[model samples]
Target: MATEYAFDIASDLKTVQALELLSRHISGLTLTWNGKNRDYLVGSTINISVSEQLRSWQETILEGFGFTPTLSVGFRFHNNTDFDAFSEIMFQATMLLLEHAEDAVLLFNYEIIVLQRLGGKLVFNAGYQMWDDDWLKSRLSLPFERRPLPSPLL
Candidate 1:
């Protein structure tokens, strides 16, 4: 069975703008819509959605940071069987969105991973430790390198 991973990004850009950005940058994905749900599908594996609404709590938090996010982008890896592939795609898409967004916050496991303000300042939170952009990028870029296990005792 495949494990599911989900992430949400709060951005100042509207839903249409976010969709356009992703459509332009990421190729080979089919876009579809149903009511307010706009989904970008990668076969039956990945689904990215954009909505004009933000959770009330998210809106309040972004407001506290002086950013009024106009929409929320949700990335769902429904059929993620390989951790490395999932990590790479998530990291790349998150970075691309952050670059163009006026202000954005990335949430995973209900915790804030990275928050960027309009002034180009990024704050990364990983438990008790803090991370810089380059550090986070480097870590995500490689995901996990495969290594051969030690031979069993002979």
Candidate 2:
């Protein structure tokens, strides 16, 4: 079986705004909209989608984290590819969303990767064992705070 890699973020940003922001900041990806769903094809390898609604359990979990999510952005990876490049894009995308949304939480493979609240403060997690922000920062090379990335209009 192929290893499954997925990331989901529950955020207060509207679907349109999320799509727009992602399309602008993350380069070399194109988003095609169909009704409420937006699909991003990453070099014919990974398929990404935006979900406007959340399941009851998802909502409950977000609330437990002190977040009131309005919509969810989900990325589903179906095939193997250049994982390093994929990770970079995912990191950039997560930062972009967290920067713009007031309350947002990201889940990787159904595990909480990181979360932001009150518009600025961010919390990082590595499963239930490790909760060190430094570890996460070094692993992903992620900045402790938000920073601007070059945006190429989509």
Candidate 3:
């Protein structure tokens, strides 16, 4: 069963502020939810991993408050994003959550960045990426090495 953490984060604050408040309640990476769960980005998928780390948190910090908070953290990630990009963020987020699974549920967002050459002295960075399964319109037709550099599927 899910019990309130007793700290209600404000809705009106900017994204960064909400992050700050949330960190106070449960330190580490997390995703913020908008009303009705609409904040979820389009084309995202939820992946969950279970481990002994989660067990330790529930038994130590949460169980004492009459809160038997038992859960694998939940959130979403873009389904079509590149594997390498997702892997990097996933690795980091998972490690963090497992380390503090007792503190709170983690909802984290991952973004990738790519740097490319522009004019002689200028460098351009792309915002998002085209992944393997992306459609006919996808630029993935090119090889990962030959392909234009990719950015995180933010």
Candidate 4:
């Protein structure tokens, strides 16, 4: 078993148009807008958590890639596996991000301290109680924030 059913990608989408590129590649993917962001032509994030699981009988596919950055990124993923599936996805997601930024440093933190299931019972169980206790927050790209300042009154 592995960790995670969803993945979120962040990058500058102006020249790369990352969302469009990824949308074409990922299966069972959808592009959503929250109507809360107003940054144009700079940064875009794509969330891609899938319900599919990679069967243990199959070999783990390693992309052999990622980045070397130094920024703080905080994110939590769902733990959907009974074994190391969660850890494997952690590596996979790192590679996925590496494919985009090519220069980031991802550290696991506030992890495992993290989802969803449906049934008539609607039961919930949480493992890795202290998941993020250590931490692996990453620095994907250069630290960047888009903020519009007010004009001065003359």
Q: In terms of TM-score, which candidate is strongest? A: 2
Candidate 4 lDDT tens digits, 1-154: 2222222222333222443444455443455544442111111222332122133211111121121122222223434323343343344444444355423322223121121111111111123232232232242232222222121110
| Ordered list by TM-score, greatest first | 2, 1, 4, 3
Indicate the residue-level lDDT of 98 in model 2. Answer: 66
Report the candidate with higher TM-score, 1 versus 3. 1
- Cα-lDDT of candidate 3: 0.31
Q: Is candidate 1 or candidate 4 better by lDDT?
A: 1
Candidate 1, residues 82-108, lDDT tens digits: the string is 554555565566678776666665555
Q: Where does model 4 exceed 4 Å of error?
A: 1-16, 38-75, 79-93, 110-154
lDDT of 3 by residue, 1-154 (tens): 2210111111234333333433444333344455542232111233322212245654542433323344333334445655454433443433333333322322222123221212111121223242233331242232222243343232
The true-versus-predicted C-alpha distance at residue 7 of model 4, in Å, is 11
TM per model? 0.62, 0.65, 0.27, 0.31
In model 1, the runs with Cα more than 4 Å from the true position are: 1-12, 63-66, 112-118, 128-154
Model 3, residue 66: C-alpha shift (Å): 19
- Note the Cα lDDT for every prediction shown: 0.54, 0.55, 0.31, 0.29
> Candidate 3, 82: how far from true, in Å?
1.1
